[model samples]
Target: MSTTQSDRLRGLLEPLVDAKGLDLEDIELSRAGRRRMLRIVVDSDEGLDLDLCAELSREISDKLDETDVMGEDEYQLEVSSPGADRPLKEHRHYVRAVGRLVKFQLAEGGDLVARIVDVDDEGLDLEVPGVKGRKPTARRIAFTEIAKARVEIEFNRKDKKEEEA
Candidate 1:
């Protein structure tokens, strides 16, 4: 598939995400039935909330409508946060995920979870635990070996406490 359209969609969404201090996780702008589906998955360093989703959806939809980026046909735009199971890729992906716990299945067939200690154009340097004594070890996984990676939701005490507090 020509990723040009997809890139264009990302270019379109960047402004809104930047304005709100949110990271654009992923975007799939394509045709689904009679309308196009503009799936924007966003997140933040802290996390995501219902309010954020609503705000982004409203603002992004208005901008898209104003710009007419989708051409003549009507389209369905979905602005959502990537949630806990969201994948990690790209420089911005790792940048947003810095200090967050993440899990990924290695190409050789083992899963690892660790805090993202650092990320750069070079690769992902994670603070993973050692298998033996549970020592904190920094493992630099090359971007090529990263078949899959996602933010791991270790716990949601804040979201829960808000329901109580």
Candidate 2:
């Protein structure tokens, strides 16, 4: 999609998302078979649910139908939250992943899998799990050192409180 079109869509939809207590994370316009697809990814600190997505979809469809921005083109609108494994790009993404395990690809050429204990402007405070019956150790990683990061799914992970108890 053209930058101009994308900008226009963001400008139009951002306020709507914000008013509903969510952040508009991404907007994509792509081709799906013979029709165009407009995918809107939104999120909040409180998280998202199917009912919320449905509500936002209706609001977005109404806005698009009444506006001239889409120019009467046939397109399908999809409103969704970012998937669990989506890359952590922005500072807010890292903040939201606290208490969850993440896999990081270091710019210095190595990988680290750890749980985020805290986050700040400079970097992250991670709890790296130790092997061979060792205790988990605390570590820090600067933002500049990370090439990529994404949350890792844990099927049988226990909450910190549960472990402590």
**Top-scoring candidate (TM-score):** 2
Best by lDDT: 2
The whole-model C-alpha lDDT of candidate 1 against the native structure comes to 0.79
Q: Which tens-of-lDDT digit does each residue in 1-165 have in candidate 1?
A: 565766876888898998999877788877878988888988777777888889899998888787756788888888777665667767777887777788887887788888887887877888986787877987888777777888887664244357688
Candidate 2, residues 54-110, lDDT tens digits: the string is 999999999988888777768999999998898999999999999999999999999
Please give the range of 10 consecutive residues that has the lowest summed lDDT in model 2: 1-10
Off-target runs (Cα >4 Å) in candidate 1 are 1-3, 91-145, 151-165
- Once model 1 is optimally superposed onto the true structure by TM-score, how far is the C-alpha of residue 85 displaced, in angstroms? 1.9
- TM-score (all chains, Cα) for each model: 0.63, 0.92
How much does candidate 1 score in TM-score? 0.63
Clashing pairs in 1: none
The models' CA-based lDDT, in order, is 0.79, 0.94
